[model samples]
Target: MADGCRRRIVLPREPHAELAAVPLVDLLGERLGFSRDTLAEIKLALVEACLNALEYGQGEVEVEVVAHADAPARLEITVTDHGAGFDVSIVPQPDLTAKLHASRKRGWGIELMRHLMDEVEVHSTPGLTRVRLVRKRKEA
Candidate 1:
């Protein structure tokens, strides 16, 4: 609806559950004036976060989106889950140069999220994990 408004969605933990990101991204793109390319990036990142929650979380996954009311508006999205969390520092960097067959497919989500979003924050504990993504609205 209005700028600075927030919306939240809670999803079950299941295969392909990340599909919920589609409508959320569409709404954000329309309301916040996100470019096609930016929307694509946001969608991908949101899916990754959701997938992680579906795969590893112990309870329902929560996605929250906030549209800021600032001079240069911004959007903040967060994906949270109650699960057995891991230390983010331990995740090794992905070898982008490696061939698809040679590289492991397990650890690229965090890296991709960081590359796509202007800011990424991850907080984890024994029972909770939260991934936050932020991007600034493009000025016309």
Candidate 2:
């Protein structure tokens, strides 16, 4: 691929549709010389972003991946959804103890994305939400 190459994928609002984008990223990451661990982290972060869009969005979901061809290439992924957005600041942190005992254990998507990606940003409004994730290629 050349410098500043971008890949765009649109998935229907269906369960597990987020998985469709994983392989593409995996392939791209491999070609870009990302390590196995880095690739795994990128894939996981991408999954969380896609899941958020699929579960919360009303219509189709759009994923755009940009590979910046620099000395250490990085991937910029943006997941956009058309749905009623919620304030990201209001989301409370997941309590480990409570989650352990609670029957329904979830709500760690944001944290996971933040931990896995170098940068994670959630931009949301009344009818649009965009999750941007970036992971830099680790120096081997």
Candidate 3:
């Protein structure tokens, strides 16, 4: 597929908690022709990023999705916020083999986001934080 197939989106800085998120998620899924299950996972991942932005981001938030409908079946999405960003290193990794009862509250978002996506990338400075996520399409 041509690079023209790539898709991207940007949300205004500090979007409303309950508004604007679902539509963005839907648009991303529709653009990629993702399966129902994949769509759900992507939607949740997008929402998680937005929620984190609302909680910690200050100015504006930007999100981008790029789709390549070929061999790898891939989707690339990036979320950016102009707020104080965290050091990605500190988030704890979940021990799946352990019981799920001892869950902690604060850092689960990063953990889940990383697990759900095939690739996770973070770029942050004092006032800007950007996260890139990728999910490969199913093989034909």
Candidate 4:
């Protein structure tokens, strides 16, 4: 992959816009030869990020995917939004031991992203919030 192997999509903050990540992941899978499992992981993480943006963001959401040219090639995806972002540190961790029905359905997105991707980074401020997901390319 070359440095120019990057695509960016701007989406309206709507529920349907979350589906856009599906085709984007498909393109990445075709171009990078991602494994089925890897593609699924990427898709889930992307959807979660997009949903979060649509739910909390005030304006358009941006999704960027880049395939790096370095050895042991990697894919870097970023989901960003310009909105009144909150403090990530304050989000409570899910208590896995608790019954699913009783547990609060919050804070799982970030945790799921971290669990599925090789690297996950979240940055948030008053005007901008970014979630970065990275995964190594599977060897063919």
Task: Give me the candidate number with maximum lDDT.
Answer: 2
Tens-digit lDDT track of model 4 for 54-78: 8888788999988764766777889
- lDDT by residue (1-140, candidate 1, tens digit) is 56337778898545667987567777766677788888888888888888888888887889998877565777788999999998999988888566366745577888999998889999999899999998887798
**Model 2 — TM-score against the truth?**
0.91
lDDT of each: 0.82, 0.85, 0.71, 0.81
* Ranking of models by lDDT: 2, 1, 4, 3
TM-score of each: 0.88, 0.91, 0.76, 0.87
For the record, the alpha-carbon RMSD of candidate 2 to the native fold, in angstroms, is 1.9
Worst 10-residue lDDT window for candidate 2 reads 1-10
**Candidate 3 — which residues are off by over 4 angstroms?**
1-8, 12-25, 94-104
Q: Which prediction has more favorable lDDT, 3 or 4?
A: 4
The pairs that clash in candidate 1 are none
User: How many backbone collisions does model 3 have?
Assistant: 3
The residue-by-residue lDDT of candidate 3 on 1-140, one tens digit each, is: 56566544556544365235556545655666677788778767777877787678887776766676665767777788888888888766756555355565355677778878888888888899988888876655
For candidate 4, the per-residue lDDT at 19 reads: 71
